[model samples]
Target: MPDLGETYACVPSTERGRGILISGDPKSDTILYTNGRSVLMLDLNNPLNVSVYGEHAYPATVARYSPNGEWIASADASGTVRIWGARNDHVLKKEFKVLSGRIDDLQWSPDGMRIVASGDGKGKSFVRAFMWDSGTNVGEFDGHSRRVLSCAFKPTRPFRIVTCGEDFLVNFYEGPPFKFKLSHRDHSNFVNCVRFSPDGSKFISVSSDKKGIVYDGKTGEKIGELSSDDGHKGSIYAVSWSPDSKQVLTVSADKSAKVWEIENSNGKLKKTLTCPGSGGLDDMLVGCLWQNDHLVTVSLGGTISIFSASDLDKAPLQLSGHMKNVTSLVVLKSNPRFILSSSYDGLIVKWIQGIGYGGKLQRKENSQIKCLAAVEEEIVTSGFDNKIWRVSLHGDQCGDANSVDVGSQPKDLSLAILSPELALVTTDSGIVMLHGTKVVSTINVGFAVTASAIAPDGSEAIIGGQDGKLHVYSVQGDSLVEELVLEKHQGAISVIRYSPDFSMFATGDVNREAIVWDRVSREVKLKNMLYHTARINCLAWSPSSTMVATGSLDTCVIIYEIDKPASSRITIKGAHLGGVYGLAFTDDSTVVSSGEDACIRVWRLTPQ
Candidate 1:
């Protein structure tokens, strides 16, 4: 059986013209962000090390750590707030239904006793303050005419709460049973973010009009504005104060993050860190955080840019990966270090274990890649654009080369074991065999082929159909000759895989059933390995062919041993926040899995 080991979490999801939130722990160097119902915590020292907390049922929007660093309060799109432990297993403490719409931001009081959440609501108020344990109302939010975008709390004595909104206003509140004190209309456009300095003596607000204002923390009195000569050229989305309260950082849509020095009740630009990109929409900087000596920002493409607080002249170190659901994964046999993965939006990223993303493969068009097949020197891929591309691999680098258009959409791709260059592609109309870069033969099977696999000897192949039938064929001169038809599955076959040693094969269907068949007898060798409750998304055989693993849409991963097929099985529930999509065995004792959560996880197999 296998146990979960390390997880490589994706970057925070971002949107245009909106503020993205990232919170840092008060006691440690970890920062938190939300993506697809999961809150990810990444260590500042080692960006590859990550932790995922996935108890939220709806899409998570914002999360914040308590002042004591003992608890975390996270909210979702359904306006549900959940408080959980910060250590051990991260157990849930309480759950509350706060509003009717999306929660944009949340903050904890200086004493870690109460929490305030603000966002878009229906007929009810968009802001609410309640006790941490009992969910009792502690304060009211009453000054915004539209959606509240951000919120903050005073860090010193005489508690105060501040909120900014699309109404172009910043509201101030005071007390335990807090009441609205005043509303400051300083910006001519929507206010995106508000934050109080660490010393609780000053606060700052940034808006879409390319303006930032400093105010008196206690009396809500207007102080001074940031220097406009060197200010942001586009809308500012987020602001963060340094730990010492002498400096602040702001990220804007102009693809830059600037550091400002606060002196004499005014702010002046100290340095500017411009993100390097192609000037596309993905280059927009949406969120930022300054904790300890590290400054982190996230772009709309989900890349995390990290900068040093003492020096902003050098280029920032970037962390990049897939931002959407992963659909296909392939591990090269020649070198196991290079891993290639494709997402739903046709983006492909190559990753090296422990070192992070290496580079990306350029797609010819906007079409999802269905499957990938690897050889010794090149990799083959089939896409929804009805074309096959060959990517040449040299040492650790790979790039796209020649491509040929198939007649129909390709569903699956497989390569011959003896002759790796011989590839077979299953399509809606038939099967197409390609030798090198040209289509050698095309066979119209007259059925919708869903999946296919080739034998290691390059002598036989099996094609699965949507009608729950398997057609066996013999390879003869780049053509498939039909032999027999087998009917055991009740639903469409989604995946078919053969063991590395080629002793047996496995088939999984949409009805959540998997069967292992003996190659010689062509009969069911194991049928009781059916514990998944939803569609089986992927399956993998260990390198030694001792065990098989299956990933499902039910958010579970199950491992079945070949010797004790019926009794010895390990079920890992909630393996991913969303459904699992791809699985690949790195070695006999290790496997890598990816899913709709946009994260890649590695598991270690141990003998039980």
Candidate 2:
């Protein structure tokens, strides 16, 4: 038998979001789900590869395997539910509208004969059990005054069902006719999840009130309430019983997961696992599941941390990919071994060094990164969500990304090595020179800047803005001496990069052009319309500065030579199935790009 942890295709929660649940078929060794717009069937035993489920109009919220393990049912924020066969050769079995609001959860009957329950958002919540074979409604259970959160049906004979919602009621129903039996209002807050034990002896309910309760399987009567004196500190989001029913595991917003011993006189907590909370906005624990003997926890920042009940010292494994839109990427200059990425939802992932490129990913603090710049052994990231973060790369145990408040939203950043004595950072509001953590000087740019870059020598810096012009500022003494406004692009400049020797610099614009300028004269040496079909997302200069690479919204990567015409550049079409969003050039011959496809592709360039 495969370990239950092996069946999760994708874990969506982030460090601050919630605890993660690893759900799928251990029998098939497959975790069926979706990543972004594509559905995927991942082989948990061998996670390096996966099968794609193509594209959807919106991002997927939940995916589950049918009881017979023949089909997968998935729902999205658009309230669209799709049923597709599990086999790669199978086709779409059904596609239908479930609600006008976001679908929170969906479940199929144990026999795979029908999809018993589905729910949507807010006051529009509806519980309708439908026949799968005929695609017809069988029964409707209604009474909740708020959004339905979770629903489940009994696995065995009695055919009883239960649902919990924002109305703070756990409603019970009996029969194939499915009538409301009773509504329990013991919880003070929203009920998030409900599930029955595998043997149908008991059912577990978790709520935002920070409590987990056990109920009798035969009747809806409460058996016992589990409290934080047992180890949890915040609202519990999810709960699952051990396969043998000996223990119950609950994930909480307090940044911990607790395991409770059921046979004890008071239902004692056997162990408590404290998850390292991400500073900034990434502190929520959202989802969790007990898979086989291991406890799998997920957070809002998209970190999947796996722990063993037997060994409490450390997590055995951690998995990470995408939980939201990837916004920025930076490759280490000295070592092409690692890549740093920032997501729109405020997750920073370090794709570490390794062979076959299957290196591990380390998620940093849970805050949206606005800009990132690497200096020597430290990587500094600024967030519009507030706080400037500094992360060290000197330790064996990956150092946590630590943040400090700079009292303003940093819109852009650039690093310059000024005579081995100073380093500077340019922001939307001002220019700041740093000596370690202390700010030595500040120059107000007086405009909302969007892009910035430092010359190779670090003596000069340029800031671009919504004003459609570039401001060249020369660092002198402790302040900016003066500013020169250069030729403006038709649209705002999005990114800027300098040549290795500081002799030249390039700025990428929203108008799909990359303008290269001479360092001393500030003369426009070249103007290349690299992305004719779409906006240029990013641009990277090769190590020698002889070649430049640009990624665009057209899902293509174009390599341009300084000496060649823009029409004669080398273009790799479909560099990413979706539009390329980030680009990094490793040395003079290699380039890497990450796209909306959630993949980073490496390409080798040769001078022609």
Identify the candidate with maximal TM-score. 1
Question: C-alpha displacement of 121 in model 2, angstroms?
Answer: 4.9
What is candidate 1's lDDT per residue for 1-608, written digit by digit as tens?
Answer: 46776676777877777879899884778899999888888887787778888889998999998988888999999999999987789999999888788999999999998899999987579899999899999987788889898989899989999999899999999987889999999899999999999999999999999999999999988898999999999999999999999999999999989999999878999998988777888889999999888899999888888898977776788887777788777877777766778877777787777676676665445467777777778877788778888878765556567888988888888888678767888887889898877999999999989999988878889999999888889899888999988899999999888888888999999989888888878888888777999999899888788888899999888888787855578777777768888888878777788898988887887867
Instruction: Report model 1's TM-score to 2 decimal places.
Output: 0.95
Candidate 1 ranges beyond 4 A from true positions: 362-366, 395-398
Query: For model 2, how does the per-residue alpha-carbon lDDT over 176-257 read when each residue is reduced to its tens digit?
Result: 7788888899899888888887777778788888878778776888888775576566778787777787788787777677
For candidate 2, the per-residue lDDT at 213 reads: 76
Worst lDDT run of 10 residues, candidate 1, spans 358-367
Cα deviation in Å at residue 118, candidate 2?
Answer: 3.8
List TM-score per model, in order: 0.95, 0.75
